[model samples]
Target: METRPRGRDGTGVTNTDAGPGLVEPVPGYRTRVVDEGARDGPAVVLLHGTPLDLRAWDPLVPALRATRRVVRFDARGHGVAEDVPVPDVGRLAADVVAVLDHLGVADAHVVGHSWGGEIAQRVAVEHPGRVARLSLVCTRASPFPPFGELAASLRGGTVDLEALLGRWFTPAERAEPAGAAATVRAWLRDADRERWAEALDMIATFDGLADLAAVAAPADVVVAELDAVATPAHMAEIARTLPDAACHVLPGARHLAPLQHADAIARVLLA
Candidate 1:
């Protein structure tokens, strides 16, 4: 991977690639897919959350590429994915399988963060054979309360973007490395407003707990100790519900634990 400061401008092209490699498995939405690592290595797919693109995985991608073929993509309504009608969890899950099929990948290790984590759960449950292992980071199995509130607040026109991010991440975390907060802030700002809102609306009403029993992959549920959206208790419940799931709580992290604690998350994904 090229070293270009690790931030994408919503074009679906990262530092390593010169052009967007888009695939349209289904009409209307063109998904941006990227592949890295060895030509003949175990495949691993990384999924990003709402309001951000695949660049959210920049911190963990290099480490994962060391031993696995790391794939990252921009989900519909985010990054380079065309602005189409918001898709339900089922369609989102289908998109993942389509991306894998487009790459001719029979199976892969799946990793997701926040909203992406919920989609990852759907992929493991809905397409059990396609996922070798699952890693859910800072996600919940049931509907997320914070998203509902955020949608309502945004609709009411009473929230500021920066303030909203502050609520998602702690003040201390935003202060870390001086410019850590800028990357995420810019990502959210560049997203298509209509699509971003619709995606959040869909996520606010989603629930994946009903399908937990069908997930056959060995799973790791990682949560941040300071996460307010997907609380530690909620993640614990998710872990307990999964027949083959283990939970890891990283200290001093927030909702963006996958990026904030990338090393810890990489360890979990690599394990």
Candidate 2:
């Protein structure tokens, strides 16, 4: 079997490819899809959460490429995905299966963070054979206002983008002009206001919580110790709901654990 690929310094492999090997998973629904890592290794699909794109996974992919086929994409209406979006969460779930089918991957380890996890869970139920393992990071199976009371601020009035960003980063991180927090801040600023609000509305009323019991694949439920957005208590319920699941905590991490604790998450993904 292939062992995990290592960088020259014994860390992780360097991804040198400039990629977005496009695949039209659904007709008229083109999104940016990037394929990386070992060609023959088992596939691993990484899905990003709201207001972010596939680039959110960049920090985490290096750690897996040595021994796994890593695939990531911008979800509908985010990143390079067209302004038009799938109608609802169920359609979002269908896109995941479509991506795998485009790759000719029979099954894969589907890993999602936040809203992405909702999509992962749906696929595990609706397309069980296509998901070998499920990993949910900083996410929940049930419906919860991801933005808390701030969600109302997104509706009808001017969005306090800064306030929305504060929920994901420290006061200090928000002040900085660069770094993970700033990167996300930019994504939100550039996001189409209508689509961003729509994305929020979609998650508000839809979730995979009701169907967790039917998911047959083993699951890895991970939460950020310091994440107020997706609190551990809320995320913990995902593991409890799934028939087979193990929960893990990324210590000292906030909601962006994929960026803050990429190496550790990489270990969990490969484990």
Candidate 3:
């Protein structure tokens, strides 16, 4: 296992050839994961969203490693993971479960951002026994209105990455377009658009509001005050449905709060 600094672009870029833990070959793809922490400590899993991989969690890993065994992984078709034939929320959840099983973790606290939040919800609902807690950040319970159309536009390869990212960040962050562009480029380089499209489609059809009531674990909803992608209203609704849940709105933050406000997020998760 090797660790290296990935610069300061919030991209978590690294070229470590060493794969995380054990790679399990699923029917259509293989999953790569990093499992590191004290064996007796509580287990925590970090899931990334579209256009990003496990490295997105780099900002939070160091802090989380102090108290819990931290596990981060690249979703199928992202990062070094193999691209599977079919990509959907259910499949994505299954991939997560597979990683957990591989690591011999029966239960864990799961943290997910953006599209990953949708996968986290599915995992808690479909594999209730495996999830002890959940942290949803900058994500929604269901797909945004007309997400299919939006995805189609994205797939057409005509969308402006800068403009899209601008909507996700605050004005101050947007002012540094070069940094934002670098981050976006890193994601695009590692991401598979077809897989991204499939994941987005799954989110479009997902409805976890009803399932949240059945979750038997605690949940935390972190919303960026200035998030334009996943609005505060969407997070509020998610918090309302959970049986035991709390909300924390990060002031002046944007969609990538976990990266921009990593220390605050660490405090909340560790608390």
Candidate 4:
């Protein structure tokens, strides 16, 4: 395993030397498993969203590791797994399944943020046997009204990545923006523009409203009170769809609530 500076968390990121355990070829991508805590503990899978990588969960992983085996990996177009094409929601969920199968994990508590949440929901719907529980943070049940426009705009030209980051973090977070910027830069460095555009296209065209009612897993829907990306109403709607889901709104947080309120999210997920 190799180690590298992953910002202020003190814990150096662990690179899986031989790639995560998997039977079939993942086509263009590789997987890395960051094994933490007891090997026999409950498995918890963490998935990050667009413009960010696995490191986005750095602050929360340690907290979660105290009681469970926290597994975090970069999405196909996002981190170390940079070779896979940007995929639709179903394919994204399949990627999660592939990771679990590779690691010999039968079932796990799945936690996802933003677009990652969409993938998580699909996993619960399509591959229900593999997901033990679900946690959706700053995510929506279906494609938002403005997603098409946003995807078009992103495809048109270069995006002001800094401005996008500014909108996600609170004023206090913006005070020390280096940490967040570095995370975003790492994702950008790993992702191709065409792949990112394709991912956005998939997101814009996705429709999951009809399938949400079939989800039977226990779920927790977390929303940031000040989130501009996925509004609180969207989070509430997601909670409403699941038969056994509950909602929690984090005060004084923006779209990046999972990062700002990592402890709280970890506590809820572990509980």
Estimate the overall C-alpha local distance difference test score of candidate 3: 0.76
Off by over 4 Å in 2: 1-20, 146-152, 155-157
Off by over 4 Å in 3: 1-22, 170-181
Model 2, range 1-271, lDDT digits (tens) per residue? 0122233444333233443355579998876677778979999999888877777887888889999998888788776674866367778888998988887889999999887888888888888999999999997666566543344665556678887677778899898877887777777767666666776666676666769888889999988998886788877877888899988998888888897789989888888
Backbone clash pairs for candidate 3 read none
Q: With candidate 3 superimposed using the best TM-score fit, by how many Å does residue 232's alpha carbon deviate from the native? A: 1.4
Stretches of candidate 4 above 4 Å error? 1-13, 16-25, 170-172, 175-177, 185-191
Better of 1 and 4 by TM-score: 1
- Candidate 3, residue 86: Cα displacement in angstroms equals 4.7
Task: Output the lDDT of residue 45, model 2.
Answer: 94
Residues 1-271 of candidate 1 have per-residue lDDT tens digits of 2212233665425533434566787777776677878648899999898878777887888887877888888888787674666678889989999888878899999998988998999999889999999999998788765677777766676657878678666677666655557677766666666677776776677787868877879999998998887889999988988889999989888888766789999998888
Q: Any residue pairs clashing in model 2, and if so which?
A: 5-66
Model 3 per-residue lDDT tens digits across residues 1-271: 1122342343444432233233664665655567765557899999998767777887788888867988887787666663654366787788888888877889999989988888998899889899989999898886565667656867898656666666666456656645543565557544567776666776677777788888888999999998876789888988999989999999988888877788889888988
Candidates ranked by TM-score = 1, 2, 3, 4
Backbone clashes under 3 angstroms, per model: 0, 1, 0, 1
TM-score of each: 0.89, 0.88, 0.86, 0.86
lDDT of 4 at 209: 60
Kindly list the per-residue Cα lDDT of model 4 for residues 90-136, writing each as its tens digit.
88899888888877889999998987888888999999999999999
